[model samples]
Target: MTSAKSSENKQAFINGWKQSKLVRVFLYFILMLVFFLSSYQHLIVSDKNMGENTSEKEINQETPIYSEYSINSLDFLEHIFDKLEQINLDATFTYEEKTEIYKLYFLEEYNKFVEDNIKTMQQSEDSLDAAFIQEIENQLIDQQYDFPVEAFFKLPRLSQAEIIKMSAVAESIVKNLMKEQIKEADIMRGKVAEMVNASNLSDDDSRVLVTEIARFSIFPNYFYDAAATKEALSSTKTTETNYLQVVGLILLVILFVVFLYMYIKQSNLQIRNNNVQLLMLVFIFIINMMGMKIVALGHSLDYPYLGFLAPVALGSMLIAILLDYKLAFISSILFSIFASIIFNFENQMFLFDYRYGIVASVICFTSIFAVHKASQRSSILKAGILITIAACTSITAIFLITNENVISNYIFSLTFALMNGLLTAVFVIGILPFFEAAFGILSPVKLVELSNPNHPLLRKLLTETPGTYHHSVMVANLSEAAAESIGANGLLCRVGSFYHDVGKTKRPNYFIENQVNSENPHDTIDPDLSKSIIISHARDGVEMLKEYKMPKAICDIAEQHHGTTLLKYFYFKAKKQQELTGELEEEVKESDFRYPGPKAQFKEAAIVGLCDCVEAAVRSLSNPKMDQINTMVDKIIKDRLEDQQLNECDLTLKEIDTIAKSLKETLLGIFHSRIEYPELPSRDKKGVTKDEATVSI
Candidate 1:
């Protein structure tokens, strides 16, 4: 039996996929591809700088590059040669110049030795000029230059013969210093001190000559060759993909999809059945992933934690408003995982950044819970402020835990978190109307707007059918109280009640509630004709609501409020007349006298319908006492339950009893003052209260 059941369910799933959801599943597949490609950079497992010269096995863009003197020393020599030639420099004039010239010409060792033995890469001209000037002043052992002697002859521009001698001495000192593999900038003067002490010249001449060489000679060069590394990095391509990570990503995505499917199946089956709502969820999810990916790309810039500005809570907030918050919670967890992967670069393999993920999750949590049932635009802003507090709190906690204690970094992260919160709320508020219009779903804000007394439909109902309008208002009061007592949507019930009898506007006198005079439209009509007119109101109200572009929930309540129950007033009147004409009960089919209906499909509809009957029944009394109102409320609820009108809805028998009690209490309050009026002794006539629930019909 279990096997058969499983097979049946599997087949049902296959049939469903082939019937309607194939396109949606295909779109999710495409989304998976987008996610994989957008996150490709971090998914790569292989080393980016896979060369022997790279000092670190794993290299990101932030790692500084170095060029060793041996591998690129010849290129450095040629670079200096080109730079000096551009300035029309004489190669034999300066120490750096003579060193190159002696290696190229005198020693005939240009091919054997590194060019000028230059130790550093060429920076921009401005940078090199600044470095040269700064080094000349700071590199010497003696702080003082001979300013008085420079009055006769400046230190750098000596006579030609003195220039020749000093150039030769400086060149020899540089060659000896290069042979010692001078690598530290801070100790260049100390090394020069050793070279000067060992010099064959007088101490003053050697000291003066070493100063010139030290300025140009001190730089770390015998290091990881940057030019070779650049060449390798540019040439390197990750041809071998990380199939493990790819498989894991695919599995994770499929798992998320399954989790979402199961969650919705159990908790929000309405979203599963509604194609537009399902499409809305997909749109929000894809937009969130793309938004996070785009924001994470900003982390490559100068900002240390740019991804904190991503509106990571956007999807959950939108879903919470437009759909159920329970669904929003599921979406939030999946969004956080994607955020963790997309914003991560601090870990090896750039796998995850728990800081960003935790902060984003916090904001998502706060936003969904805060604004799930919000009824005003300003409420979204309030939720945003709450999200900001939560996001900043998460950031501070994460930073403290990670020991990233820099105050400025903390300030920047907090600033971006604030923006993230604001943007999340603003985006949700801005796009909400468009989603409601496009998806045909009603949010709390839209519901409140529709509930306004001055709305066009409500005004029309008041002007054209004032009696029915007042009747609807009474029903709304009862419905809201009853709905809240049963943990149903009270606002939806109230709003639905306001428009439930709007069809009376089309033929105002046809309904008793709208007839102010003694004229009766039903009196002239036959019982069958009266039944048709009475049943037409539910369908007509639905049409009017549709014409006004009212939300489906309100339209549905108008349509299903009568549920297929018997129009007993007309049916019984026809039965009585038929029996006088010698017809049997079976000859007058009961089904022919019923309202065409799909029944109440949810608790709100059932509550509204129940309260509609109870209110009309109680109002039928000329002077209903509290005890009479209580009996009327309980009898109507009992009648609906016995007729199986509430079977399709999720309301329990216990909740029905609760709704009956609430309706009785609300009716008591509304009619309590009426008890003080003079009682009509004829108010409790036998036939008058027999079928009071059928007063509207």
Candidate 2:
């Protein structure tokens, strides 16, 4: 007893929590937060490159100073060689003048090289080649030149052997000097060629010289600057400012809050009072957005719209099925907006990419439209197909209009779009039952399933109480039409009517509908006892429904169909018998003969009750005429109205009149008079004329 009480209290608290206004507000806020966080990474934290400083001076200043060493070594050597070669040895200038000029040029080149290298070393942190610099300084300081050009020119008038020997000695000295400063063999060879070509000697002697001067001079390309490259790469990475993004996020949040507020305001009270549907809506939205986010992260795909495969229409279909189309449409719009944000691969925060958004919106809207009247599970597949077609068509049209590569985009977009539909169908089939069970939603698909003749209770009614099953079927048909006319749930009326008389199956012989054995069980029983048996069916049906775990709405219809009306047939019989027994003064309470009921609390249940009576009354008529059908439907509706059976429901007088007309037309069609048939010709024993024996037409 303690455990039971604790469990009851826990359930009550849960119910209270679910219905609390503060809890609703908190849940709405949490949904808003989920919306914000789902797109935050894509919208705010992406690369912007706003803080980079691209000034030329900054780039040049940060350039590595060691690059100057490569320039100094190559340029200084070329300058010395160019000056030496430009000397006018064949002109009026003497050898001393050329030698002095050569010495001055060499000294200038050497001083410049040393100065540039020292400057480079000072500016560079730790990358300068110190050993190479020292070697250059020692070689330049130790080198001695003795003006061998004049000696060679004076001895050049001698034999070829002497010229060759002189040229060889001169070449030897220049090669030795060139090897001192230039470490690379290629640069050393070029320098030696320049030195040998500038010698004051004959053409043959110069040609026989070891070094040959090429027509063109080689200069070094710019050296790679490790520090400068590193600095440039680091500079490209900018520190993003969050002020604008924060503002944008705030604006978006405000917009979403306003939108959600309007949505809640326009929704039904049931939806407003229950947080399950609201949370389910938000959950579907978040799941789709998260799926899109995951897809967007793979930007490496060739087709930009390949991420359209995310089941954007899944939420729309679910909302349309589990709730209504208006909410589905609104949710689709919001989802499209978020999709645009997530698919904005360029990170244009406030700007939306309508290319994907439009496609998603169109697909979702089409799915909702297609599934708006869906009453079966297969309808979802139809909606999926419609969604896929919309997706592919919209995507293809956009690509065509925008002059994108149609062939490639179509290949990927079509595949993903088709998969989008198939996957949506799969997901809806898998998750719809969960939502229905969780939210206690009696969807049209569920109603259709329950209305099938093969249900356990329904089959039992067919086999055990076949007469009641037929009566229930007629009631279902009548109730479906009447409920539709009055804007009630016709499917609910039909399904509820099917199970309303299932209790009669337990005592088939006791009820008039199932007494096909030509025996009335009530004939031998007392009137009071007969009334009790008749009134017990309604309560029995309620208990049976509860035992079978049927939906509460159906159980209520089973219990309330007869309401608290007086069982006049049995009441009058008992009163007549009492009069014969000299107990006429004893009062018979009307309540004892009535079926126990809490009245019909909803329009569908009330309509089902009225249809049940109309069907039974019309079925009992030997030949139901149009006038009789009309009178019967009207009288049943009038009687129920007078009994206050419909007072608790929201059915208006105009709707009641409409239901009467629908029931009358449906019954008249069912029991319309047939044409009289002529008797078939029958031969007499003597095989006389058959026309004489046949009846007249």
Candidate models: Cα lDDT each: 0.70, 0.70
Please write out the lDDT profile of model 2 over residues 470-575, one tens digit for every residue.
9999999999999888667888899999999988877788988877768897889999999988888998898999998888889989998887878899988888
Task: Look at candidate 1 and give me any clashing residue pairs.
Answer: 66-226, 67-226, 68-225
Task: Work out the TM-score per prediction.
Answer: 0.64, 0.64
Q: Residue-pair clashes per candidate, as listed? A: 3, 0
lDDT of 2: 0.70
List the pairs of residues colliding in candidate 2. none
The positional error of residue 606 in candidate 1, measured at the CA in angstroms, is 2.8
| lDDT tens digits by residue: candidate 1, 13-111 | 754653367656765576566566656556645344323322322333444333223233223333433433432244346654544443344123332
